[model samples]
Target: MITIKVPCSSANIGPGFDVVGLSLSIWLTLQVNIVTTTTTTDTTPPPHTLNCNITYEGEGASHVPLAADANLITRTALYVLKCHGQRTFPRTTHVHIVNPIPLGRGLGSSGAAVVAGVLLANSVSKLGLSKDRMMDYCLMIERHPDNVMAAMMGGFVGSYLRELDPADMERKEIPLAEVLPEPAGGINTGLRPPEPPLGIGHYIKFGWAKEVKAVAIIPDFEVSTATAREVLPEVYSKKDMACLSPITGTSGIFNLQRLAVLTTALTRSPPDAELIFQAMQDKVHQPYRKHLIPGLPEILASVTPQSHPGLLGICLSGAGPTILALATHNFEHIAEMIMARFKQEGITCRYELLEPAYEGAQVIES
Candidate 1:
């Protein structure tokens, strides 16, 4: 039996906007039991001929798919196996997944699922791949470094996709549908999937203040990432990119300046509440996403260092119906205030105070 545990993550992190992420304490765990059958008679079935059984519980269990071909975790595992020239599980595999991370609320549920899948493939096939190598497979599926990188590496992290060579660039463009296919029967064994280019992503882990904790103010609704992104403008005006000019900067430079400061600001011993509160402000995604999340603007404006002393900063978590607030103390007060603002908009919410998970993903065999 092999056990894999992957942590949930919060991406964007205010001004970082698809560039930074923090791994949280919540987790998605996968327990695998591969049964090996001894051949006694001619009628004994071969390992590849047996099917995988998947069972899921917690969080999205009510709606999550159980079939190996359809589940994201299983599909991802199959993609890796196919890319490595191993077409199927070597034995009858039983995988049971336990997830506590909320799905589609910008909490990196999908990213965690993808990480678990890659780990599953590595363990089952005895790939002996390094964490970096496993990350290559993960990046191929998620296509973004922010959420997936943090979930895999743990702690606070900043990541970027590498510029591939022309030949590999074409390979990178392969459609996601082809990457993780859902055939009516099972994974397509006829055509080999495009293997991820080696070293497709590079990342650095950042330091996080031990005192600073995350308060997740999650609403009782889902905001798909696609819908949140649809509201953003493709191009920015001079005003949006302007910084330190006579006129005020709006978006681009606004995020850049803050993001530069925030990466280090969070590592200081005595965190600066006021500085962090300002640093966490965004001009990239959150402002545009306000319309999708009711009371978003109000909560960001009303909750502050002056109003809530222990509060350091607050921002929309990922694409968000969940608001993440960084604070030192007075967690309940901060949560209540944010929840009250959401309540005014006729939205109900719950809160969780989480610490960063220092260790990324873990695997155990017995």
Candidate 2:
């Protein structure tokens, strides 16, 4: 028997779309116990005749459909078992899940499952696979690296996949030099992503900060991840992508500035709410996702220093509905203001005050 506790995650932190995330305090606990049993009196249970019993607790457990196709946990578990070269399923296997995070509310419900499934499989099989290997498989399964990192490694995280020189792997600070590798065949192949014969494939970087905390305003209604994704435009101008300087000047949400502010905000013990508020101001996905959340515009407008002094910054957690407020103080006040805004528009909502979970995902026993 093995028990795995994986923290839920919040991703796309404002400006850093698909690149930033944080693990919340809430967790989805999975308990898997493998036992021996046979249905037939002759003791002839077929291959994969595992008595699989799955149970769920907490938010969305009642109504949410648990289709075998959509259950990342079960899928990844089967994959992990396959990876371990385990051909036969346990005769009697009981799997239990307890979730506090809301599904389809942009609170990283799937991310938790991904982490949980991989961890559960690895533990049950006694694979002793490295964390990196687990992460690679998880990314392939979930398609969300930022959320994966937060759930796997915990705390506030900024993650991205990029090609780089092996020599630059240990770069501690800024002033990076890009040195193109010379081809072994002598012919120049021009600049390209590092993969295959060219070099090692793209590697994902996970930067973690354990100090930052957040307040999530989770609404009663849900937003489908696919629906929210479909509404976003397929492309954007480079200037719009980077938020070009000069014209917008100081007020503009420059990528470099946003990145710097976010990293600093997370690293600092007592996060600067005003700085983070400005830092998290994004021109990315939120504008397009507002309509999905009722009274979103009003909620955004409701947070002010005078009204919600504890609120550091607020943005859509991932794709929709649930809004996260990053802060170091006055969590209740910030949550109150957000709930008030939601109530003003007759929207029912609840809020949770959460600190960053630095441990990520771990097994309770060996």
Candidate 3:
């Protein structure tokens, strides 16, 4: 039996939309057992018969699928195996999942599931793929590097997808249907799925101050990432851009400047609450997403280092209904202020105080 553990993640980090992420303490764990039951003393390779069972508990237990073809983890594992020329799972396989991360709450639930799947395949097949190579498989499924990379590598992380050559770009454009196809009539052995472009993602881990911890003020609701993205405008006017920019600059330049500063600012020993407060301000996505999340503007505008002591910075966690506030002390006080604002908006919320999961994903066998 093998046990795989993966951490949940929060992406965007205020100004760095889709560019930065931080792994939190919550986890998604998978316990897998693969047994061989062969009565015949056959020397040749056994037929690829599918016998897989999955059981899930925690967060989305009522709604999450258990079938191998429908579950994200198993489907992703099968996708990786298919790429390496293997068709089916071992004759007898069982996977038990315990998930704590909330789904559709911008907390990288899907990303963790995908990472767990890749690790599962690597262990069961005895594939000696390096972490970097396993990341390639993850990118193919999740398509976003911020959440997945942070979940896989841990700590405070920044990542980007590399520019592919013309041929590889074409390969990159392969539709999701083709990449993770449903095995309608058992596993398809016809045309092979396109493999991911080599080194398609590159990332670096950033330093985080030991004093800083996160307070996740999560509302009792779900905000789909797709819905949050659709509300954003295709272009920004100069006035709209100027709201976030210190100078008369475009929105892109505004976020870039803060992102660069925020990355290093977080590494400082004591941490400058004032500097981090200004750096965490965003113009890219938050402004448009306020409608999706009630009391968002009030929370960001009212909660400040000056108004509340011990508060470093705060922003929407992912495509959130969950707000993340970074702080050093007075964690409960910080959470109360945000929760009060949310209550005024007729929304009930719960908060979690979490530290960064520095170790990231791990696999253990017994």
Candidate 4:
């Protein structure tokens, strides 16, 4: 049996939006066991039998569509199997998914499933696909490369788009280069790069694993991506742009200044209440997306005032009703305090203290 354990991920840590993501240890584990086909002169069940059973558990099992052809993860695996030239399903394969990740709340639950699908296919087929290639396939399926990278590579990753160079592919002979192809042809053709392309992509590492513990507070309601995108204005006046200069200036958020801001904020306060609260400031996305998140003001005000000294930063997790607060170390007391603060607001929320997962997604034999 091939068991694929994929980490859950949270993207857009405040200002990063689509460009930044972090993975948590909590995972959705998928176990697939291939059933034996016919034996020599003996009657054995045939592989790919229509009677093969697929089961899902944990987070969204009931809601996840049951038909193998309709299931997202199953479909993804099938795609890979087809790519590997496997026309038939393995006989009586039993598939199980244990999910801890929440869906559509900006915690990357979907990305985990996509990753799970690709990894499961690779393992079952024994197709020795390279990690980079597998990552590319997963990312293409996910469409959010940064989050996919975090789900695949683990830990904290910062992504920025760059033109794909054709020379990079002369060695691999990848038929499609727009994703990682010759820069000139792909760029000229206006063909967008595929989601979740190969390599770790253009990314950088920040902070240590033990040094970070993230607190994710998810509100009850869901927000549509379209609505959140609409909240972003298409244009801003030069004066409004000028007003943003300081935040966008040499020490702007787009740079390491954002992290510096958090570090500085935490350093100044008593390390209990003041420092951590001050560190949550954002000049970029939060201020804009707040409109979409109900009770955000109350949630923010509550968490900020009761901040723990160990806290590094706090910001929206994607287009969120989910908020992520990061810390320099384990802060159980602080976490309880924060959770209490939110609970008092009567918001339906759950919190988990998680470290940066650096291993990404992988298969475990069961």
How accurate locally, in lDDT, is each candidate?
0.88, 0.69, 0.88, 0.64
**Residue pairs with backbone overlap in model 2:** none
- TM-scores for the candidates: 0.94, 0.80, 0.93, 0.75
- Tens digits of per-residue lDDT for model 2, 208-270: 344456889888888988899888889966655665456645444465578677776666656
- Clashing pairs counted in every model: 0, 0, 0, 11
Worst 10 residues of 4 by lDDT: 181-190
Off by over 4 Å in 1: 38-50, 244-252
Better of 3 and 4 by lDDT: 3
Tens-digit lDDT string for candidate 3 (184-264): 755663238778888989999999999999999889899998899899888877655554434844345667778989999
Between prediction 2 and prediction 3, the one with superior TM-score is: 3
Question: What lDDT does candidate 2 reach at residue 3?
Answer: 82
- Model 2 scores worst on lDDT over the 10 consecutive residues at 172-181
- Over 286-320, each residue of candidate 1 has an lDDT whose tens digit, in order, gives 88999999989989999999999999999999999
lDDT at position 300, candidate 4:
58
Model 1: per-residue Cα lDDT at residue 133: 95
For candidate 3, report its TM-score: 0.93
Q: Which stretches of candidate 2 lie over 4 Å from their true place?
A: 36-43, 46-49, 64-70, 162-212, 242-253
* Candidate 4 global CA lDDT score: 0.64
Of the two candidates 1 and 4, the one with more favorable TM-score, higher being better, is 1
The TM-score measured for candidate 2 stands at 0.80
